[model samples]
Target: MLIAQLSDPHLRPKGVLYHGIVDSNAMFAAAIEHLNGLSPQPDLVLVSGDIVDEGAPAEYEFARELLSAIRQPLLVIPGNHDEREAFRRSFADFDTTSRSGPLHFAAGDFGPVRILGVDVTVPGLHHGDFDDDAAAWLEQQLAAAPGRPTIVMMHQPPFACGIPYVDEYWCRNGERLAALIARFPNVERIACGHVHRFMQLRFGGTLLCTAPSTTTAIALRFQADAEPASYLEPPAFLLHHWKEDAGLVTHLVPIGRFPGPFDFA
Candidate 1:
């Protein structure tokens, strides 16, 4: 199965600009166009989080239109910048319910392969959480599909990735999240966004990756004297492919075409 992952689009309402520099809406449109041009096309398009800048009604409308251009099924969840009520209202098709604490969503099952979208956004807070209800929901899903190859998706990464500013607001209940994930041997990978950079790490015996932002990045300034990584960086996303025999492989697809390949070696 082929899955295209795009994160942190941070798209704003029309005529609005993010941070007075990055053109988030334009960048996201570019990303959508690029993804639609893929050769075999993807079975699904997954937006890990930050689908909008402020969860504004207008922003969702724009996001919906842009995402509609994709010819494949699209799966998404809320990010720190997203509003839970707004997201639920927008994506009404997903079986969303209050269910005590956090909201849960799941879709698509190709026999032994299933995709699960879990919401971890804590309203009004920058950090994330898996809470007890969410943990139970995830466990139940994995348990029910013991023989299936499961791919878990969320907004914040469960592990630290050296970006202190982002790390500070990462998933707080990761220990519980990791522990819950370890029980499911069928789980092949965990995908997340929010850190505005492409990173890979291991957690709960599975691969975890953070997709690059389709919009601008959160200036890489780790501290006062540390250099900076900012909007100057090009936009990028991820293409994840999974096969019955080979497991899974992910490619970080940048938006713009690069100059002739240069030898890194």
Candidate 2:
């Protein structure tokens, strides 16, 4: 099974640009076209978070309309920039039981892979956490299906990615999350967003990967004093392929046009 993951699109209202630079809406449209044109289309598409820039009703409406064009089944979670109420109302069809409380946490089976989506976003905060309620709920989901290949999805990455500016907002109580995941050997990987760049690390015996935003990318800075910044680096998304015997493998697919497919002469 092939699962495509797009993160942090940060779509804005019509004619609005993110940060007065990137055209998030246009970038997202291009990404949708690319995904639709894939030779072997993805069975499922997961939009990790940051569906809009300002978390406004109009912004969510715009994003919902754009995302409706995707052919594959799409799953979404909330990010720091997302407003829970507006986001819930926008994607209400995805989870009907999510009318109240944290926007739905559940396990879904897609072929051989089981997807566990958890809500870690804290309203009006730039950071995230898996509090007591979320932790207990996640544990229940993991226990329900043991030894099944599973992918955990959330907005904030639990581990630090070395960019001090971004690390400052890393998921709090991450240690608790790691501990819970350690007990579940079936957890193949933890997919995340918010960093706006591709990042990977091993934690709790599972791979933790952050997908790049389709709009723009965050600069890679190792210096502690480096200010928050973004760049025009080619945006991209992740394609995770699962095989019965080979397990899961991920490929980074860049957006936009480039010369390629020339046969070696």
Candidate 3:
């Protein structure tokens, strides 16, 4: 099975640029085209979070139109920038899990993989949390399918990625999250967003991967006093290919029309 993960597009109204600089909507379109161009196309696509710049109805409306072009099955969770009710209404057709509550999180089987998306977005705040109720829910889901190769999807990464500014708003009570995931040996990885660049860390007895954005990357800074900023870097996404024998391997795929892929002479 193959899965493509695209994160943090931060879409605005049709003609508006993200943060009045990056053309995130157009880049997201390019990402859709890039996925279509893959040789062996992804069986599923996962949008980790932050579907729009601000939690606006118009943004979600435009987002719906844009996401309509994807060729594969898709699953999504809310990010700090996303509004839960609006997001729910936007994806109402695809997800009929409930009419109320936190972003309709649930587990579903897609061929060889069972994917469970956990919603931990903290309302009116940039940070998130793995509350006791959420932990209980996740534990129940993982326990039900112990042997299946599973992937846990969430917006905020459960571990610090060394970028002090971004780390300030990381998932709170992450230790509890790690402890829960450690008990589930079948978890292939913890797929996350929030951080705009590709970041990976060992956590919860498995690998944790944060997908790069379809727009700008949050500037990388190790200094504690560095101000938070973004860069118009090459937009990218992640591709996870899984096989019965090979386990799960993730590849970083850069978007846009780059230079030629010349063969070695």
Candidate 4:
């Protein structure tokens, strides 16, 4: 199974641009085009939160139209910037059951690989957490499908990225999450977003990967008063390919490289 991951589009309403520079709408469009052009074609497309800037009704409106064009099945969760109610209303086709709207989740089986979308967004807060229910649900899901290679997806990472500002807001219940995941030996990786940078770490014997935002990347600064959140890093995403024999392999594929020769020897 091949999963294409896109994160942090921060889509805005028509005529509205984020920080007077980044065009969220155009960024997402390019991302969709790139995904569609891939040769083998991913079996699934995962949007790792921050779908819109302020979760405006209009922003969701445009977002739905763009994501609808993707050829494969898609999965999503909410981010700090996303409003759960608005996100649900915009993408009613997805599976959302949590009352707080932050824990919209779904489970799917692709042969020997079991994929789970875990929601860790905390409304009205910059940081994220996994409550009792989310943790319980994960445990149940893992137990139900024992010995199957699993890929868990969420917005906030379970490990700090060493970037102070983001690290401060790292998932509060991350330790508990790690302990729970450790029980499931089948878990191959934990894919996440929210820091806006390509980050990775080892958590409880599983690979923890943070995908770069489709819009902009946060500058690597530890200062408290870092005026701006993100800088002009080329938009990129992650592609995780799963095989029964090999478990999982991933790539940090950058976007917006046009007219470059395909052979980069």
Candidate 5:
């Protein structure tokens, strides 16, 4: 199965700009065009979160209009920038999207891989949570499919990414969640997106990767007091391909029209 992952489009209302600078909607449109241009195409597209800049209804409305261009199926979760009620109302027609409460869901019909999405956003906060209830719910889902190869998707990364500014709002109480995941050997990957950068880390007896945003790349800084900022670095996304013989491999693809593919004899 081939899966394409897109994160943090950060869409704004029509004729508006992201952070009053970048043309986020147009950038998102380019991402959609990029996805549609993939060879063999993807069996499914998984959106990690932050589909809009604000939790506003208008933002979701614009998000919906932009998202309609994806030819493949999609499963989306919410990020800190997404408002729950507005998100639910906007994407109510999607599969397994929670109609109320936290937007947690599990689906097994997408292909050989089973997808489990855990929403950790705390109503109005910049961080995420993995409390006992959330862990229990995850445990239940994992227990029900112990033999299935699974990909766990969430908005906030459970571990710190060394970027002090971004780490300030990471998922809280993540150790408990990690402990539980350690026992689930069928889990192939823990995919997350929130920091708007490409990163990979070892965690929970599996690989956890955070995809780059389809819009802006967050400034990469490790200094304790590094100023927070985002750049117009080339946009990027992730693709995870899985097969029975080769396990799973994830690729980072930068979105743009670069140079040519010369023949290498």
Candidate 6:
């Protein structure tokens, strides 16, 4: 199974740039085009979070218009920038249930891999939290599919990424969640977004990778007083391929055209 992960599009109302700098809409469109052109196209596309900038209805409508171009099955979770009501309204079809709550929590099988999409957004807060209910639900899902290769998708990473600015908003009760995950050996990878940069860390004997943003990137800084910053670095996404023998291998696919494939002579 092949899964393509894109994060932090942060789309705004048309004609507006996120932070008055990054042209999020254009970058997202390019990302869609890139995914559409992929050879052996991914079986699924997982959009980690931050689907819009202001979490407005109009913004979601605009995001919907752009995201409709993706040919593969797309799964989305909520980031701090996303409003559950607006996201639920715009992406009604993706929700696992029609009942009112945190948009949805979904789990399913795709070929040989099992996917679990969890919601960790805390309403209006910038930091993430996995509450008792969510943790228990995740534990049940993991227990149900013991020994199956599983991929966990969420918006906020459960570990610090060394950037003090982002680390301040790291998932609350992350250590507790890590303890739960530690019990599940079938959990192969935890895919996350929200940092707006590509980062990988080892946690609970598994890999936790934060995908890059489709709009802009967070400047890499480790100072305790570093202010939040963004740059127009090459927008990128991740591709996770699952093989029967090799488990999961990931590749970073960047946007825009670049020179390649000269004959090796």
TM-score for each candidate, following the candidate numbering: 0.91, 0.97, 0.97, 0.92, 0.98, 0.96
Q: Pick the candidate with the highest TM-score.
A: 5
Residue 256, candidate 6: alpha-carbon lDDT: 83
lDDT (C-alpha) at residue 112 in model 6: 79
Error of 2 at 177 (Å): 0.9
lDDT of 2 by residue, 141-233 (tens): 899988889999999998888899999898889999999999999999899999999888998889999999998888899898999888988
> Among all windows of ten consecutive residues in candidate 5, which has the lowest summed lDDT?
256-265
Best by lDDT: 5
Over the stretch 6-118, how does candidate 1's per-residue lDDT look in tens digits?
99998888878877777888888889888888888888888999999888999888888778887877778889999888877788765543434455676655334588888
lDDT per residue (tens digit) for residues 1-265 in model 4? 8989999899888778887898878888998998899989998888889999897899898888888889987888888899988887677766644555455565664345667878777778878888887898889888988787888988888777767778877788888999998888899989999989998888977889999999888989867665546787889989998877777998998887668577777
Q: Which is the winner by TM-score between candidate 1 and candidate 6?
A: 6
Q: Candidate 1 vs candidate 3: which has greater TM-score?
A: 3
TM-score attained by model 1 = 0.91
Candidate 6 residue pairs in backbone clash: none
What lDDT would candidate 1 get against the real structure?
A: 0.82
Model 6 TM: 0.96
Ranking by lDDT: 5, 3, 2, 6, 4, 1
The global Cα lDDT (0 to 1) of model 2 is 0.89
For residue 41, model 3's alpha carbon misses the true position, in angstroms, by 0.9
lDDT, candidate 3, at 173 = 88
List clashing residue pairs in candidate 2: none
In model 6, which regions exceed 4 Å deviation? 95-98
Model 5 TM-score (2 dp): 0.98
Q: Over 4 Å off in model 1, which ranges?
A: 94-101, 110-112, 221-229, 259-265
Candidate 3 structure quality by residue, lDDT tens digits, 105-166: 65565679888898889888989899987898889989888999999999998778889999
Indicate the worst ten consecutive residues by lDDT in candidate 3: 95-104
Question: In model 6, what lDDT does residue 103 have?
Answer: 51
